[model samples]
Target: MSVFPSPPSSPPSDRRRYAIVGLGSRRELYQDGIEKVHHRWSALVAVCDSNPGRIELARRRSTQNGAPVPLGYLAADFARMLRECRPEVVIVTTSDASHHGYLVQAMEAGCDVITEKPMTTGAAPCRQILDTCRRTGRRCRVAFNYRYSPPRSQVKDLLMSGEIGDVLSVDFHWLLNTHHGADYFRRWHSHKRNSGGLLVHKSTHHFDLVNWWLGAVPVSVAATGKREFYTPAMARRMGLSGPHERCLTCPEKNRCGFHLDLAASPDLKSLYLDHEAHDGYWRDRCVFRADIDIEDTLNALVTYNTGATLSYSLNAFNAWEGYTVAFNGTKGRIEHSVVESNYVNGREAVQGGVAPGGVKIRVVPLRSAGFDVEPWSAEGDHGGGDRLMLEDIFLPEPAPDKYLRAADERAGACSVLVGIAANRSLESGARVQVADLVGDLPVPAYAPAGARGESVPMPERAR
Candidate 1:
């Protein structure tokens, strides 16, 4: 008889600790995971933000939710926080400009990193992040939570099983509806410098999904876009002479529903009003202004390493926040979508958009004579992917076999590499390749203190 080793007597408490940077809208990710999924193995040990009041607000919110109120810290700068907190992981939800600075520092400080989508703003920073990860041997995960949705995962499974045959080409169209789309124009993200344009900031998830589904990498991209609808010039032409910004304080604030009443939402209030004592940035602004550089609408053609082609379009001024995509394979086709709810336009806007229904999937087997449409069960937020991703991120079981959704540096790089290339293409009016955009950049040996760039708010109106 084979002798079996005795099981370890003690239970596992080897949970990894995390420190969150940038206490903004995304910080709820930490709180939700703590309450629902990762409660066992991980805890948010620290929270950092340039604004002390935001930090305090987060502590208060976490406490009310029964989580260990994390130790709050001011920016103290990212480098100092990494050294002081000594966490195993860092979650970066900072401003777009500050993403690279914090990511590089955390990796160099010997911590894994989980950053919000659109990993870094541009080619230079993207390369810097890739290089640092290459050097530091730390892992990096971009929160492209959509990948975990059961329907999308099922689509991937079908592709792998050759049920959808070899994917030939992909056609994707995403809409943001008025409530969700207009919100982009109202805040700091209105400017390109702050949010890297919606193409990079918002579509990173869409582009990354294409990369994942095709099992390929983007080779080249070319795009064109315009901000025709949401501009002050157009507003004036339409017979309205409102201020360049949203008329929140205008006597007609009630008439124009896009008004961003800063006091309406608690998060908005605590973050913008109370926190303004620390930093002077404003969260609410006009959607139509002269200074916006990002496009409200964009279209791009992408060629992948596997020679698959993808056509993409993004519009921010729609009536909802979701996407619908179809994959055409040599044998069959598969499509998926999630209709998002109305954005928190203001505190009093009680309207909510229930998910349209379910992910509608169809498959045409190579030998099939007809197409079969299947409706997947409806899921929670983010097409039901958010909760699953949190489980994999915050909790893991020890075993000879384990299910993992962890992404490393290369995966992280692949997701945003196309967006970076697209941004370059946007400016040069030329087709740009991912390799060329990041070529010859130095990856830092260790996380540095800050970035060497200027901060500009997203344009209030797309151009």
Candidate 2:
């Protein structure tokens, strides 16, 4: 069966021109959005990638979407692609460390840009993106799709409505189950240099949620991290002799529960396994390799500019995937949790989709009874945030969003800086101030609310 649904017969001529660099699995959302969903408003003009196989795959996908085959370019020819294609906007779905280069180059070429999260891996590249965006006056948007999820958006609305009054602190814990979490160890993400460990690569999502939910910038971070689960010792403990190079050649593939067969899925085979000679990028390396430097367990304390402190933790090898967050406010408390289904990336499955009846929200008032608040529901990936976010990104005139979920480079810096600070703290064992990393970063615009020092209604005496 074809992966993409049949697209519109003919797209309009006035559609915005878009080119996407980095033909990874993450690029599918934008590519399909341009060709299938918002074809009337957006046209994909070019695709670029380091691997020629993936570039061809993207062109094939365009044919599947019933759209014109976009021009394909190798990574080395990116500048030439920009000059030739003249894309109005460049969508960057590159690796965490390479995002800044593509973003800056695109902006310099007089094109706006949209990037997948973490924006960049380190502080230096982040500053470069910010400086270039400011100098060129080109819009640089960070695709923080988590903020657009219906249930998550509802949380912002509740906070804005001052239902729990001024938030004083936040407690957030995120869990990545073995199925999805283990996948990270099998890819380039296992290296700190490429991904800045899970703190910047994975925790960026959690930290950004706190920043957006509180409507404040993080000021400082103190953290500790360790690799306990996905380690060489764990391989022996699981009765494997030791870690091998890749899963395809691993001798204990039958014994190792974490073994991933790229050939089992057609998408993975075509996208990665079949193209091994082009870039030699393995889709299924052993999880218990000794060279893996990223941590599996992480904990951090973040202080916000609003004087709200956040206690956050991320465990990558949990039994289930999801998160639980609580807001401590001057008047009351709000708690939200969701259990997400497990799915490996690149496969034909929803990434971060909520399980059946997995969302729960509750409010507890001081000296009063607590009640369960119904969650806002949605369908599709990431609790339907991807769909809504695509509309906002590709649509010429999307509706005014009161939540202000559309994030820019400023918001991207605010979120990743927290994780970057945490990484430094892990190495130094001292609190790292965000200002020290990136001085005087402008705060992202947020919806106005009465919570920041406004007077709260006095509660009645307890019964």
The top-ranked prediction according to TM-score is: 2
TM-scores for every candidate against the unseen true structure: 0.85, 0.96
Can you give the lDDT of residue 260 in candidate 2? Answer: 94
Worst 10 residues of 2 by lDDT: 1-10
lDDT of each: 0.70, 0.90
Q: Cα deviation in Å at residue 96, candidate 2? A: 0.9
Off by over 4 Å in 2: 1-13, 447-451, 457-459
Model 1 per-residue lDDT tens digits across residues 332-419? 6776666766665333222233365635667755454556456444345565676667766776653321213445555556667777
Instruction: Summarize candidate 2's per-residue lDDT along 1-463 as a digit string, tens digits.
Output: 1112223443356889999999989999999999999888789988898888888899899999989888888898899889987899999998888889999999999999999998999999989999998999999999999998999999999998888888999999999999999999999899988888999998888888899999998999999999999998999999999999998988889999999999989989998999989888998999999999999999999998788999999999999999999999988999999999987998957888999999999999877889998999888998999999999998899999988999999989999999899999999999999999999787788623333778878888777
Instruction: Report the number of the highest-lDDT candidate.
Output: 2
Which residues of candidate 1, in runs, are more than 4 Å off? Answer: 1-14, 35-37, 345-358, 366-369, 398-405, 439-463
Go through the candidates in order and give the clash count of each: 16, 0
Query: How much does candidate 2 score in TM-score?
Result: 0.96
